[model samples]
Target: MNASDRTPADLLSSALAADPGRPLVTFYDDATGERVELSVATFANWVAKTANLLQDELSVEPGDRVALLLPAHWQTAVWLLACASVGVIADVAGDPAAADVAVSGPEPESLQAARACSGARIALALRPLGGRFPQVPEGFTDYAVEVPGQGDRFVPYAPVDPEEPGLIVAGREFSGAEVVERARAEAPELGLTGPGARILSALPYDTWEGLNAGLYGPLATDGSVVLCRNLDRLPGETVDQRIETERVTATAR
Candidate 1:
């Protein structure tokens, strides 16, 4: 299916329909020794709950810009799809002051930027299991606290037009259609072709190239991602070990 009938959310739905048991995202944080693997159904469940949270709690609707101040984690991937599911623009590089909502990591910088958001500010602890921050920041709502209460199945309040702008990845904008088109092109570029292809990517999530590999590339091809943060900290032997352990077929460093 092409962009004419499918959005990124649709692609995910197809993946779930085809093989919900397959792993979609495998995340590793070298800094914290954390590893998380999410299957298509599991990831979709997280996305559904998150989408519900965005729609019901945050009052986010179509065309609303959400500043994503998170990192290269599984939850960030969930939020990206959640935003797409609700027709909200996921702005990875947006200014907090200009955004209607901001979802942030637990870093001081992210917390500070999220606090500056004029609209709803949400903080994610990014712990092993989406744990809440030890000391919740005053200006931000804890995502771990709010998301669990949201419905597991999400239905958008308004239908998302495929031509509507859906993502502001870095400084560039992509409509829902464009995102699917670009993913088709970028998937082969990132060697994320073939069924169940696994890519081990060490790139951060702040740029288009990173986002393409992390989210769109694999999803476009029914492939999976082993996203690595702080790659340089790992020894070369450890990297090789990961390639074997994670069953990675390609490397995108």
Candidate 2:
């Protein structure tokens, strides 16, 4: 981890600088039998494009609130970093009516919640290949469709203040600096001892601990994650095989 990282965005930048080709997030969807891997450079590019979408197309400004109604998937990770880059507050599973923008997964509950958002509404298909939805949902723009059209680079219109609230998880707020601090503190506890540490996490993103295990802990420590969705559906032997195959050093407990 870089001691100079004052914000989550800085952590990402450090990772990109340290090893652009190293695996960053390896995602699995047991329910769909899908596995997708992204290197640091690829992940950062996705974050850049998504941040551009939030800033240029959606006109998201610093301190604005973005309700993220997504699961612990790769795209969710991208959105979290994008929010950091754009200096907006990412509210995990937050109330849509109170948010300036809302992003939802294709799940019924999340889609239903997103309908409450009167401002910008974006939806992710969550397909294995990141394909656009067969039919775009009403009142919402397809993230897969729009994000790819955005520039691969992003520069915030205003400088992001590390002191500003950057995330809201389970109704608790945390600044960008606080996020880095908390992640650093929790990294070793989750067995991410140093750089190149690989963690396998099946936790959801709705809680602080889940967020730490799935995203922040690894990012803060210059590590990587093997993120699993519907992990409970996988057989014990299959899960064990995956752990060995991913060369994971830790598992989120």
Candidate 3:
């Protein structure tokens, strides 16, 4: 399939093939004193492994709802793309009880939701690196434990149709093709131009603007994102410093 006909998964693959070494995601969490940068190839590898865990380990099928009760972090971005790759519908911060599988962070709400889900549950430690949870949450598998052993290359067992459901956020569901079209349609207003557009954003994932920063914008423009968690805590000077350091071209506050 050509670039326009391909899904988000295909967009990522094209980006990787075009420039594997370019930075795709630069993440920072001031609360945890954490910073991580992943290039196209590395991020794609993470998506591959996570997708494998979902399909091979959890037996998640196409059209399955995967609740992502996680905050705005790099791993959360990985999960979003992984779900899209495998044709699983990503429910960002949605109710886990209605989902087929739930991936949560180290938050009470996420924990409670994971426990309530009827299917497999996975909890992320949200450590500086991909570390195992110091104390595993009851009734949920630790994400770090299961992700590493999986293959770095992913080949889906079944085809993921672009017209199928791809994401659900804020009670709104969008198909894979619609997600791309909307992103592309909204790109200019969001300051996402052509290649190499770098946006540094400090927005929560529960809102539509936040999802653009975390997922759609960069994908639409073949650009990069510097995602900040707990950005409200940082000083203006520090934020400016990061903007300079990261070579950010735009900001979404």
Count of steric clashes across candidates, in order: 0, 0, 0
Ranking by TM-score: 2, 1, 3
| Candidate 2 regions with alpha-carbon error over 4 angstroms | none
Q: Rank the candidates by lDDT, best first.
A: 2, 1, 3
Best-fitting candidate, measured by lDDT? 2
lDDT of residue 136 for candidate 1: 86
Model 3 alpha-carbon miss at residue 177, Å: 0.5
Using TM-score as the yardstick, the better of models 1 and 2 is 2
Please give the distance, in angstroms, between residue 179's alpha carbon in candidate 1 and its true position after superposition: 0.9
Tens digit per residue, CA lDDT, model 2, 1-253 = 5788989999999999889999999999989999999999999999999999999999999999999999999999999999999999999999999999999999888899999988999999999878999999888999999988899988999999999999999989999999999999888899999988999999999999999999999999889999999999978998899899999999984
What lDDT tens digits, residue by residue, belong to model 1 across residues 1-253? 3344457888888888889999999999999999999999999999999999999988988999999998888999999999999999999958988899998888888788777788999989998978888888888888998999889898897888889999987689999889888888878778877888999988888898898888888998889999998889989999999999999998889
Worst ten in a row by lDDT for model 3: 1-10
Predicted structure 3: lDDT? 0.88
* Candidate 3 Cα outliers beyond 4 Å, as residue runs: none
